[model samples]
Target: MRVAILAVQGAFIEHRKKLESLGAECIELRKKEDLEQPFDGLILPGGESTVQGKLLRELEMYDSLKEKIESGMPVLATCAGLILLAEHLSNDEHVYFGTLPVTVRRNAYGRQLGSFHTDAEVKGIGEVPMTFIRAPYIETADEQVQVLAHVDDRIVAVQYGAQIGLSFHPELDADSRIHEKFLGLIADCIKNNNCRKN
Candidate 1:
């Protein structure tokens, strides 16, 4: 299996290393052409959404990624990556791609000093230590989406079809289960598609 990790200035290297350890071919995607290339799955690493959005626009990949994701390209987005996949804005006027049908409030957890780590019971992954740094929360989810985990009654992880959005950075931890689960999802998508073709 091959996975593309968006290397637009974030903790992408961490994610890439974790995914690679899972026995998958890892590719760092920097330019628009990278997104166009074939891959079993893609991961959008956490970073400043505004900055990443600008880069996406400059590379002319905003629309192309939107189209590819719609065609069942599985994506795993964390923190600022979650913002990139959000559909509803926080009213703070921060730019977003509005990809997933999720309502996000940027930095709803407070500032950098308010960063905290907690144990979240992600549905498929069980209990795992989650790192939250000025992370946003999923306030609302469309009917088609299924929430995976929550903390303090606030949604932190969600899955919408082929996409997984998280307010915490799973790659920051030593656990590779989350990354493995994602690969499984990508494999499932591919298998289903091949079955349809056959």
Candidate 2:
């Protein structure tokens, strides 16, 4: 299985390493042309949402990527990725992809000092390591969104359709369950021949 990681900025390298460790062909998506390669899934890693958003449009990859996500492509969006996929940002005026039906509060945990680590239970994946760094939590999930995990009474993980948004950095830790679960989604897509063509 092949997976693409948004490499415009942030901790994308960690995600690539995690996905590769699971035996998936990992590709760094830095430009529009990278989308030409067929991928079973996409990982939008944790990063500065504003920067990634700016780079996506500057590189002319925003619309196409959004279209793919909206087209039922299985995606694992983490941290800033959660913000990117959210339909609304409670405190911010900008919306990136806005494909997932969730409202996010950017840096809701606070600034850099707000960063911390903890173990949380994901609905389908059980308890796992969650590393949050200036992360944003889902303030409100729409009717169609499934609340997967919570920390300190805040929504930290959610699954909407084939896409999953996480507030913590699963790739930054030793646990592979989260990525494995996402990979399972990709395998299902492949098994059902639902993967979109490049």
Candidate 3:
């Protein structure tokens, strides 16, 4: 399987290392031309959402990536990446892709000092390490969005269609189950002919 990582900003290299370790060819998408490459899935890593969003637009890669997500392309988004996919931000007005039918509160855990680590039961994957760094949690979701995991009674992981959104950094942990689950999603989409091109 081949996956594209949004490398314009954020902790993308770690994601690349994880996916590559799982036998997937990884591509760093830094320019519009990079988006033209054939990739079975996409990863939006944790970082400053505002800066990532701004860079995506400034670099002319936003619209195409959004189109792919809307067209059912498999995506694994973490932290600020979740903010990019959220349809609404309860605390912030800016919305990036608006592909995931959920509402998120940016920096809901407070500041960088609010960051913490915990082991949680993620629906299909049991008890995996979750690292939250200035993360955002889902406040509400549409009827179709599936709640995958929760921390401290707050929604932290969700799946809507082919998109998997997480409030914590699974990539930062040693466990690769989350990334494996995402690859499985991509494989399923391809096998079922549900994977679409933008």
Model 1 ranges off by over 4 Å: 194-198
Each prediction's whole-model lDDT (CA)? 0.84, 0.92, 0.93
lDDT (Cα) of model 1: 0.84
Residue pairs of candidate 2 with colliding backbone atoms: none
TM-score of each: 0.93, 0.97, 0.97
TM-score of 2: 0.97
In the range 67-161, model 1's lDDT, one tens digit per residue, is: 76777788899998999989886655655567799889988876653588899799978999899888889999998899999999999999988
| RMSD, one per candidate, in order | 2.6, 1.0, 1.1
Clashes found in each candidate (C-alpha, N, C closer than 3 A) = 0, 0, 0
TM-score of structure candidate 1 = 0.93
Candidate 3, overall lDDT?
Answer: 0.93
Span of 10 residues, lowest total lDDT, candidate 3: 189-198
The CA root-mean-square deviation of candidate 3, after full C-alpha superposition on the true structure, stands at 1.1
